[model samples]
Target chain A: MNIDLFFIPLQIQDELSLQNKTVIVVDVLRASTTIATALKNGARAIIPVASIENAVKYASTLEPGSFLLCGERGGKIIDGFDLGNSPFEYTEEKVMGKTLIYASTNGSVAITKTKYAKHSLVAGFINISEVVKFVSENSDDILILCSGKLNRFCIEDTVCGGMIAFLLTKGKSRKRLNLSDSTVSAIKLYKFYSKNLLKMLRESEHGRFLIELGFEEDLKVASSIDSIPILPIFSDGVIKALK
Target chain B: MNIDLFFIPLQIQDELSLQNKTVIVVDVLRASTTIATALKNGARAIIPVASIENAVKYASTLEPGSFLLCGERGGKIIDGFDLGNSPFEYTEEKVMGKTLIYASTNGSVAITKTKYAKHSLVAGFINISEVVKFVSENSDDILILCSGKLNRFCIEDTVCGGMIAFLLTKGKSRKRLNLSDSTVSAIKLYKFYSKNLLKMLRESEHGRFLIELGFEEDLKVASSIDSIPILPIFSDGVIKALK
Candidate 1:
């Protein structure tokens, strides 16, 4: 297994070149969790937009009332959008059978960048096992791209990425794995922070910023492991729950 | 104290902005260790050039027998240079009272990028405490720049940067320091590998590469904590031992 981990998606020089590799885009603070929750709660499909302008533009094409315009700028709902980025707002009652136009500060940008990946899976602690199982069974070359907070490194995302890497390669012979330096550092971080993930998230820079915004409960929602057991795959610019 | 650590110097947006901040450039595999070695061995002053052309150009201006052209490419001595990037070659008798023009693949590039820094200190395990002390007594806003292997992350540099961070802020109240996520990650790595740094270096990707190239002994030179007991400060385009 050849595993490469990037602390931030900005490190990717040519996103389309990743078309041959299984790319796992992780955003633990909210995006991945919100996507999983929206899908698990019966959202029809998610159109992840890189910018607010794109989100609004994409929403315009959908029939009125069939889609919900959603996103956050600086952790608050964009003015005039139907919903914010918080997972709680993505509950079944609001999303069921509706196409969601989603834009986020970091996660959506990262997800959109992986449109050319052979298989791009959205992952967070909420659906760790499903993503891990999928990668282990289907991938020989794996790239775990952390959606850092707007081009800067985010501890929560890297830690989550590390956890996925650790679980996938744990107990395996070292000879079979070609891991990068960042991957090795990441796995070591996973070992250090895995004991109490909720605490880890609460202490993270982005997590603290979220808490300061009165979204502490969002941390709890994002930290639950395997609660939403589904792989939300990104393909051809749309995200949907993989059956 | 506010501390920010970057895995590679590429992260610096404006290298001139570092002119107000004390920058510690660490390349544990060789550059830093060799710089410290040359200074400790009584080289008049070391001029670290970014590229071979620059090194040769700078060397031509100095009087013959007063300066030596030194550097390495692929861990071997560059043709027509007096020395390679090995600490063992920089004995007191060889470098005494002579200015040296130095260049290396990664470290020298990073060192030159910090030309505008208030003070750029060369650091490695060989002279860690002195680097730490210089940072502790002199500056609060600190930047630890890891000279990663040619823009790609190298575990050894990050580990060395982490060790400096760990030693500087360990046991201090968290309220005192504003560290970035990468800083927190680096310190954790320092803690994880502190027990046996030599073994960690031996296993790192760059370390293994150095060993494969018959520089296994160089790792021993680089990994010796506080053995050199000197701080090589880069200032006015030249590096010299801090008095």
Candidate 2:
């Protein structure tokens, strides 16, 4: 197995290069967590748009009451949107059976860029095991793409990526598995911070920014491993829980 | 002091943003090591060009015997160039008092991009202490730019970067120093690998490639700490050892 990791979407020079790879997009705090929560709570499907204008445009095509305008900009709910990026905003009662037009500042942009990937899945600590299980059983070439904040590296996402890479390669022979430098570094980082993920998140740049924005509880939710154990796959412009 | 690190040049969206910041460009495997060696051996100045065409174009303006075209493509010397990117090729007998129009695949491109930086210095493990001493005594806001191989992360450069960041913050309080996620991660990676840099380089993807291409000796030179002991600063389109 060949496992490669990209710290941010900027590392991807050509989106078409991902055509044959199983791509796992990670946005630990909190797009991946929020998406998995929404899906587990029974959101119909998530249409990830790169911009607010696109989200609104996609919303106009759906039945007025069937879909909710969901997403965040700078860790806050977009003005007049139904929900922000926090997993707490995605309650069972609020998201059940609703289609979401999501437009986050980073995660959605990264997810949309993987439209050409063979299998694109959204992952976080909440659904790491599921994503790993899916990739381990079905993938030979994998790309762990971290949706870094605005094309810059963020610790929480990278640590989450490291955790996923560590899980995927655990017990595998070093000779058979081809790991990129980023993958090797990610695994090392995962081992260093795995003992206390919440603390690592709290000390991260984006984590501190979110905390200042009154989203400290969101960090706790994002740090819980395998809490929402569903594989959210993005294909054909929509993200849905894979059965 | 605020310290930031970039794993690759792609993260830098605006060159102007680097203004007023002391930028340390690291390409540990060869460029940084070779440039330091050439300068320490009595080269007049090193002019880094982004492409072979630029190197050739710049050569046309220099007196024929005064300059040499240097650099590599795919870990081998470029066709008909004066030298490959190995410290061994840059002996005092060959390079003394001559200007080198250098154009390696990754490092030169990264060096040229730092034209707007307040002070841009090339670094490898070979001249680490000298570069660190210069930056520590002269700058407040710093950016350690790892000239990652082709805008993708390379272990050697990043570990070297982590080492620099680690040294810069050695005695400082965490409360007073601002570190970016990349900076923190680089420091952790440096700590994990500092004990045996040569072994780490031998295992890195690029390092293995250079080994395969018969440049194993270059890795040994690059992995050596402060062997060259010179600060090669880039300014006014030339790199010269600071007197």
Candidate 3:
């Protein structure tokens, strides 16, 4: 199967042409893990917005009792947002049956960019095996798009993309991992770092950024492979858990 | 000293905002190498352009017969261009005392993006020591911008970036690396693959792309470290030898 890859920094979202492609939105740090955990814990739905303003406006339209404001900026929760972008904040009772209007500095911007995609699936190392299985079952052509930090390449996302490429290439050699230079390097990186996911995340730039912001525990949650099976797909501009 | 690293993929040219920063343009595959070699081989000046059309348009403004056109696309020479994007082709006899209006699929696009920088220098593995020395002498924040292939993170560029970071951060426990995740990973990849530079290049996706396009020997040219030492810096949108 033919697969395309996009490494997006948040600034170039307007230039992305994701139509007719199964766009996999990968934000390995926290968004994918948080979304998966929220859904697995029975969170009703997650609405991703590009900016905090949009999240606030979208929440105003929803029933106040059922919707909660959420998101982060500069790795910290917004001053008045109900939730910070941590997986731990998404417990079953706290999130269950409640719609979360989520926005974050980078992840939400990436999700919002792919809102027009034919099929957009959120991926992280945490649920990679499931992602590979789903993509293999629905294989036609794919775009492995990484949600880089503000229009720059982040090691975690590229490594995660590399992991997906590695699994797909290893599962069946016939698929011909016809990849770009970046893809080849990423696979090599995944091979080198996949042996220790936690260590890789802990030493990364964003990892340190999150750590400085006191979100070290989230890295552990995000790094756990194949822990969640739900696919967070974006359609009609809403990200809902897909079983 | 603070360093702000930028991973410049080809597609994000217009968005490059290098106001009042020392920008280093990196294209480890060939352009950076070619420019260094050309400058070292006694070429008077090299002009980088984003596209073949731009190269032609810029060359048109130069005195007739004063400049030669150079560049490549898909790793080969563009039709009617005077030179393809390869260092070996830029011998002393061909380039001496002449202006090269150069363009490539990736490298030149990245260089053009940094036109607004306070200072712009071309970088490659070949001149690592020289580049490092230049960076060390300057106390201003250093921007290691990787000219990713077609707006994607190519391994060679990242590895090169990592090498720069490693060089800067080695043996200094007091001074933190404070690098982006990509920077940290690039250094690790460089250390992982430093034993065999050509082998790493040959196996890399970009290397293979070059090989497939009949530019296999170009990889050898690119792999040779410290083979060229002359620095090419851009000022007033013009690149000239730094004597």
Q: In terms of lDDT, which candidate is strongest?
A: 2
lDDT per residue (tens digit) for residues A1-243 in model 2:
999999999888999999999999999988899899999999999999999999888888889889999999888899989998988888989999999999999999999999999999999999999998999898559999999999999888888888988888889889989999999999899999999999999999999999999999999989999998999999999999999
Q: What is the lDDT, from 0 to 100, of the residue B87 in candidate 3?
A: 86
Q: What is the TM-score of chain A alone in each candidate?
A: 0.98, 0.98, 0.94
Q: What CAPRI grade goes to candidate 3?
A: medium
Query: Which sequence of candidate numbers ranks them by lDDT, best first?
Result: 2, 1, 3
Question: Candidate 1 or 3, higher TM-score?
Answer: 1
TM-score of 2: 0.98
Error of 3 at A16 (Å): 7.2
Q: What digit string (tens of lDDT, one per residue) describes model 3 on residues B38-152?
A: 8888788888888777888898789977888999988888999888888888999999889998888888888888887778888898888788888778766677888877666
TM-score of each: 0.92, 0.98, 0.89
Model 2: which docking level applies? high
Instruction: Tell me how each candidate scores on DockQ against the true complex.
Output: 0.63, 0.90, 0.50
Over 4 Å off in model 2, which ranges?
A: none
Best by TM-score: 2
| lDDT per residue as tens, model 2, B1-243 | 899999898888999998899999999988999999999999999999999999999999999899999999998899999998999999999999999999999899999889999999999999999988988897559999999898889989989999999998999898989999999899999999999999999999999999999989889999999889999999989999999
